[model samples]
Target chain A: MTDPNKPASVARRTISTPLILTAILIALALIALASGSRPFNQTVIDIFLRVILVVGLYIFIGNSGVMSFGHIGFTCLGGYAAAWLTMPPMMKQTLLPGLPNWLMQLQLPYWAGALIAALWAALWAAVFGKILLRLSGIAASIATFAMLAMINTIYSNWESVTAATSSVVGIPIVRTIWPYLIAAILSVFIAWAHAISRAGLALRAARDEPTAAAASGVDITKERLIAFVISGAVMGMGGALFAHSIGVVTPDTFYLTLTFTSLSMLVVGGIGSLSGAVLGVVILSSLIQALRWLEAGVTVGSTTFGIPNGLQEITLGIVMIVILAFRPSGIMANSELIWPRARPEKPDEMSGTTPTQQGVTK
Target chain B: MQTLFDALSLGSLYALGALGIALIFGVMRLVNFAHGDVISFSVFALLWPSTDAVALVFAGDLPWFLLIPFVLLMGAGLSVLCELIIFRRFRGANPATMMIASFALGFVIRYFLLMLFSSRPKSISLLPALSQPVEILGARIPLLQVITIVATIAILFALTAFLKRTRFGLEMRAAAENFTMARMLGVRANRVIMGAFALSGALAAAIGLILASQTGTADIQMGGAVMLMAFIATVIGGLGSLPGAVLAGFLLGAASVVMQTLLPIDARPFRDAFVYGAVILVLIFRPQGLIAAPGTKERV
Candidate 1:
């Protein structure tokens, strides 16, 4: 989606960012596969899922410079959708008896279920986005959060169809993780393609300079709605995979905890940078894994070393604050993972004078 | 009539929370995610640190006079302490950074409480006398309910007067309206911000006391639902508008109570969905909020 007028070298560098990210993810997946350890594999899978979510979040929030508190709600929707489509007919008939007769009778392969889940979530995102995209800044964020709360409330109380607050079990757990890797990769490409697309550019323009963007004939709300639906689709796919990973779907699972976790990762990584989105997940997930290991105890020579059980969360919070204090824009600071030396030689790019490069530098 | 009182009491609680949020946002662009944790902390301060099922009453045993000030002071002190330690460094950072930072700070407060008190909801029979039934017109209400309504009105009047009549209140209002301009015009930024935090913290404490009395329990997560509703109210009221926040808070509370009463029994559990749906509608129709605070429109 890079503009055709852009010089070949710059385009290559822009393309390298996603390629590099994909390579890194592939390497991690291969490492997990090689280890053949279930826990480590699960840990890697968890990180991949987060990458998809944060990347999905970045598609809208990073580009639009709008903070969203509702993407997780779409994940909840997708999880239930996946559960509805993939669960054995017997289980659905017995547990979710209020499901329509056709839905109760039907079951699909995991991929088909995930695909449908993505569409189902995206379809609703369009519905909700039609209303929410009209607002911008903090008001928009709040509206999204309200949407999430509404979804959570309905899902939690709609007993027969959703199993209400109880976890819907029997999702075919895809423990092997290849599917998650593919999905995560898909999310990255989608985010990358959207970021460079005309809509993404206009949305970023509106974000950085709403007045100027509007003066230039950009339909800010329409552009924002586009990002909203795309990001919604990505979040829905991630949510489906999340359900399959755990073989359970519950409304609360897609509430504040996951919302904050992904948002924290996105912010700590850098809100405006794609590399930041992916790296945030990788770095934070690694830190969490390390903390878990310490909590379980580690041997140092003849003695065991361990932190208190609750210390991990405290440390994580403290680390987030410390990081934000030092690097307010995030670790990436709106920069991508392009070739490090490419900028110095390209004086124009180094100065970040070009309109296209403004997002990168800012 | 009972339903109306119920609505008013709930609205008052939300209004207080929104006021706390609005005060800080008026001075700084921060949404103060930690405000909820502060509420939980204030209530927890009354009890001796314990992981046991039963609370060990400490300051909680104080007569209402001393106890009230103690909890309020705890809230103010903690709010001020957070400002001094954490928020002070984030003065000019972007809104997203500050919001996330506040959230992280709240996370720390919540987990810290968890470490000391455990996640168990502790029971504390606060102001047992307030639980007695009282007559008001045709309505039989808890004395606490009436007290809550009266106390909220009193606080609102006092706040309005303070803002309207005092030099410091004038400075605070100016800062809320325009921080940089106020600072340029001789309002001390640090003092005004700190004052806002103190007032906000005290308000959180009031909420803590109210919640503790109403539920007869103190839970780590108790502040969450109210905090979310208050947050919504704050936004729909207009981000930095004090009176707007209060009015929206009350409206949301009423809407919630009414939905609970009017919805069919099967739909009653989905009351919050209806309320939130209404919130989205309000935002869509009037994104600047029910009362748009001047100069709040995004500049960039």
Candidate 2:
């Protein structure tokens, strides 16, 4: 393991990746702010939230090369933690009487609550990842899912504390897109930072050539755990903002549908690239919104036409299948979106170098 | 006696579901998430599409002999069609991509059903005669329960015989064991894979029929819980092992029933938490599963 700081190549590689990511975030934020309509603003907020969640997913699934079905468990935890911290004291006393005196009485501002939520979610991720990361491949996937099921079951049935299956209301709503925009930008930077770190390079190496990487002294488990915890924290923050957006939190909100939707965005974009994660959310979210508008009916000169309800989902599914069938590695195919270079190089070379290690040797 | 009967009945459903999942997984490493939707689709096929709470029985009105075969064929046809249209293109994709594709396909099927049936649970009295209780040794059980168990065993034995005695079965087994080698050996890859899909589809239909008869309702989500249990069974039994899947399915079903019956009344709602906890423990201890199939080891 060479020092990341010693190489000029590593510094150049690190700068470009984050620069590209920050540029994209700025473009999205500008568009969100430029849009005047409340509905459009809300839509942007949703997309930004999704971007955070998917980017969080990329930290682990991308680098570690493991598909997790359980990251939603962290989201659930974050949502609840935010709810507990931000909900009105009176309402908490009535709705969730089982909370300890401090939690029952405490009422924090949204930013503070969200920060606490992220830490709370990350703490649990560390514990669960410690146990589950030992198993690799499909077995790890199932274990994560089981963890999600466990979280869902307890949240759904713990009536006195979590309001069981019922929605917990009275959390302060933040309709302004700026907070979400900032959070989304922060999340992307965090993801970029992790992806450029020495740990990220080692994790990717382990994912691609586990036996070789292990023989070379990479601690695969530790690398995976680090990615998992970082991803978990990002997901938690996304979940907290999600609660603020909707002003309500239910266990079901953070369950299978959310999990699959985020996973699909990540895969459709290019599961292996940070640029893919951002673009995937932007593209898919736009497509869904467009379809939804069509479902609401579109006027064509003389008459109005509309797709029947439910066709949107079917269309989305077909689109996903077609995309996967055509480009199985995803839209980006493990390559970052880079500015056009003066000299063209081999595709393998571009994709092979870690985003952080791109020019270190040169 | 009652408790044993209860466990067996539940186990029979799970075993059947696991067998369907295992068969497909053996041939292709796909975990076919759409299987639950296929079960829902089969039951919905019996009724004329309607939004009413009371189902308008269409093919369901036919004699049991005709109705059963028709439903089975529908399931098999749809399953085969999915393979041809969707799974065929994903044959060479990574397992994660294929799994997501299958999940997307399931979402399509579910929403399609939702559009037709309006998401309401529809009641249909199929094989109402099976609803009666009869003496089984010292334990009285619903005729449907007894039929479910017996039918499961019969299917298992028949499938075992088919896999052992037939040329097609031998090809499928060989393909499952080592697809590339089997293909090189001149087993027609398409035919063997199609056969697995067809059989898996028919089994889904069987579970659908049994569920429709016992529960007396055809809800869009009826198959979800069963499909999830079957999926877990497939994993814990051994990813590509047929007998392992069936065994694990029964074990899981038995665990669920026993937990339900034995847990304190106040703790009853948390029964699933305990079951999932047990699942985590099992996975931690036996990551390769209770029965590790040959050549399925993780590369690292």
Candidate 3:
């Protein structure tokens, strides 16, 4: 009962790692802030978006122990909201002919649009999540993916509301470093806060053991609802930043490719940890850009490096397969690396079934 | 009338797609997101040889019968390969992981197909005679629609017979009920699962061929929208219940077509919303799925 030395040793190991990592990250951020070339600026913002996507994704995937195919739907809502609100009235009239008189009359500031967009996405999530949140594992995932497909179809075809054509325009361009930096910081903070909260504990319980959690009176549905809403809000805000960052939105933009790319970042960095989300975003986004360079018909010295024009996707697929095979748990697995505390095993651990899994699957 | 015909034909395709979806879900409990791509993959197979080699069957010179089996085999092979590589290992994973893997697999498959096919839309001409319109009670319907309906019924009939009478079919049904138990009882569950995937793939391929002929073009994105519809059909039909899927498939098809016919021109675009909305309502009322397995703490 009196293992004072061991306790102090464990504390030292846990407390020091985060301080080192944060210091390193801040240094890297400073370098990014003062980077050169157009690609460098784009890279910073790309990391920011990935940060939002990855951390938000982890909340659902890590907490409830399910993958969501429908997170893309919220991203679409976020993009469209920003696109609709920030579109200048005069410019929107020119681009989107015969826009509703009511729509044309309303105007919003850039930040307000971002906030509203986040709220709108969160609101949608609340309605959708109420039904969707309760389903775990594959059922939840399929439903989410279904939502994405259905919403994308609606967005692509609902010409009056979203544009008839796939292409959209009239976003104010703000291609700079601030948005990405702020997004990354906020996203990290959210992840940190989420991991430590009471709801987070119940979600972890649900992830590991639904029956036990249910027995303890943890309302699994409510936990999922909270995660879904908060995650949607974060993704929505990121979309707002992206709309202004990229200065355009398309139906295709928030579809599978975006979903896959975002998911890939989380996969590469690791799935279970906050640092993994941040680190994975940075590493994977840079790698994608690097891969593009390798394939971009370029020559350095007497050597030329270029893959088949369409090989980029194939390469990424290969990497994903390898990762799944070699490290089914992404880099961080489901455990965080910093400010460390005792983490519990997911209730629905893959190797064996609990009473609920047996009950449901049977 | 033309719009109504188009909607009916499209809904018929959705039902066919849904049948394949239900079979896979019923048996494996995997969402099989790749189901739609199997159809897409078959379309390319049917269209490519005809497009690339003018001498190939269905290039307006060769006999149509020779090409039919080729298309069918392509469907069968693609389904088998997908089953072997992806869905096999994923058994017993959280349904969420399985679903994501499927979604990922579907993405990779479509993009890879796109890279191979250069993302162009393709079509197959089954029969020029089948292209001409037939007048039906004030509705001018293409002969292809009639052929599609007939083909769907014929295939379903054949599948039903196969499932009931064949040794392999019995094994498949048994395995679907309980994989571990069936295996312990000496069923070669792997072989049975593969067979289910193969048969389902064939249905999708055949549907893809017939419907692509009607719609006049095909593309990669086509798989996903239809996959969701098939998912609805499967859900409505009941998980692991074959008859349930078929019943819901045909009913949903007819309902969607009727709804589209009644809708205003502008609202016609939103007909899918009505179908999916209806599915959600159905699901709320029947959470176990329309035709659920009757057991507690056990699957069929």
The best candidate by lDDT is 1
lDDT of 2 by residue, A256-324 (tens): 899999999999999999889998999899999999999999999988899999999989998998998
The C-alpha TM-scores of every prediction are: 0.97, 0.97, 0.85
Give me candidate 2's TM-score against the actual structure: 0.97
- What lDDT tens digits, residue by residue, belong to model 3 across residues B185-230? 9988778888888888888888767766666666766676666677
Candidate 1's residue-wise lDDT over B202-279, tens digit each? 999999999999999999888887899999999999999999999999999999999998999988999899999999
Best by DockQ: 2
CA lDDT, candidate 1, residue B251:
100
How far off is model 1, as Cα RMSD? 1.9
lDDT of 1 at B57: 89
- The i-RMS of every model, in angstroms, reads 1.2, 0.9, 3.8
The segments of candidate 1 whose C-alpha lies over 4 angstroms from its true place after superposition are: A1-5, A9-11, A348-354, A357-362
At residue A201, what lDDT does model 1 achieve?
77
Ranking by TM-score: 1, 2, 3
The residue-by-residue lDDT of candidate 1 on A1-362, one tens digit each, is 24456565334557778888999999999999999999999999999999999999999999899899999999999999999999999999878999999998889999999999999999999999998888888988999999999999999989999999998999999988799999999999999888777787778887777877787778988999999999999999999999999999989999999999999999999999999999999988999899999999999999999987678898999999999999998998877887676677665452122357354224
- Quantify all predictions' global Cα lDDT against the true fold: 0.91, 0.89, 0.69
Name the fnat for model 2.
0.80
lDDT of 3 by residue, A153-205 (tens): 68878876677545777788887677666665676667555644567656767
- lDDT of candidate 2 over B189-212, digit per residue (tens): 999989999999999999999999
